[model samples]
Target: MGGRGAEICCASIPRVWYPGMMVLVRWDMPDGLKHIVKEKMVEVEKYDETGSIYIHFFPNDEVRVVVSIYPGYSTAHPIRHYGKPENINP
Candidate 1:
């Protein structure tokens, strides 16, 4: 695409992927998101059909993240402090 931001398409997104499917637990994007999130388990706390999406981002993926997201959003939301290194912490 000319004059457009680079898009990193997931050539191999998990087979569980769908148009509006919710992740029940943490999921790792080692290949698709290696740059930003190395090989970490990105937690997707909860999800709704047309409402808020609860996401938890912790250093260990088992704790609660400090930041909170607004409910009932209809757009992509960015999460801070996400990702990790393959051999070390990010």
Candidate 2:
């Protein structure tokens, strides 16, 4: 399955977690958008001090963010897990 910016099905998306470093984020799309965004890479637009991480999908440019009560924690439905390849404990 694929979406606007997606060339093929993918379970993960590359994300810049630190300067010069990239990680992958595994997520689940809302049921309504799954057909439109199947396995597409979710692009992170920015982050804020409130533990909110902003994100968007390519071509569509619709922005979403994960708000959290604790640092490094997310309460957003679109996000499932994020980490390096070898240590994705979430």
Candidate 3:
């Protein structure tokens, strides 16, 4: 969302059906320092909830990223309720 900021990079997974839900994220560190983390795994807690997805990054693990995409919505779509990018620690 809005030019890559300090968060980790992400890409959406298409085809696979995940119930519409908001991913919640929590890192061992705060937001700004999250980039330095290497390997990480996103423990998918629940499905269909609005919030941040918690993540723990491995020291040597490359940052794992996930981006959400709304197919019907155009790229110009406003990131409010749909199609917002999020970072997964691992």
Candidate 4:
């Protein structure tokens, strides 16, 4: 999913994470979070850091999600775990 200036760096990952590349979208949130973004465009990238969902782009054009959290907080869904791939699921 590159436009111009960037290129996909991730090559591949376990197929079990996502046996089939799926485009998952949930339209409703209790109160729609205006902060959740597709790309890393956070305002306070350091302290007031927010949560993020990273989809690794494989060479075959497939992907898996990777969530990262900083010290602060975010409006996105509260996840159970992060930095541990064994617990994450598609």
Candidate maximizing TM-score: 4
TM-score (all chains, Cα) for each model: 0.23, 0.23, 0.21, 0.24
Candidate lDDT (C-alpha), each: 0.31, 0.34, 0.33, 0.32
Q: How do the residues 3-72 of candidate 4 rate in per-residue lDDT, one tens digit apiece?
A: 2222334444332333233334222113465543332222211212233444433333333454345211
Put the candidates in lDDT order, highest first.
2, 3, 4, 1
Per-residue lDDT over 1-90 for candidate 1, one digit per residue giving the tens place of the 0 to 100 score:
011222223322233323433333334434664633333333333222232333443444553211123421212333333343111112
Considering summed lDDT, which 10 consecutive residues are worst modelled in model 1? 1-10
The residue-by-residue lDDT of candidate 2 on 1-90, one tens digit each, is 123332224323234333333333444556764533344334343333243342333333433333232333333323433332111122
- Candidate 3 regions exceeding 4 Å error are 1-5, 13-37, 49-90
Candidate 4 colliding pairs = none
Candidate 4's TM-score reads: 0.24
Encode model 3's per-residue lDDT on 1-90: one tens digit a residue. Answer: 122224434623334436443343434434774553222334333323233222323234323223333211334211222233332222
Show pairs that collide, candidate 1: none
Per-model root-mean-square deviation over C-alphas:
12.7, 12.4, 11.4, 16.2
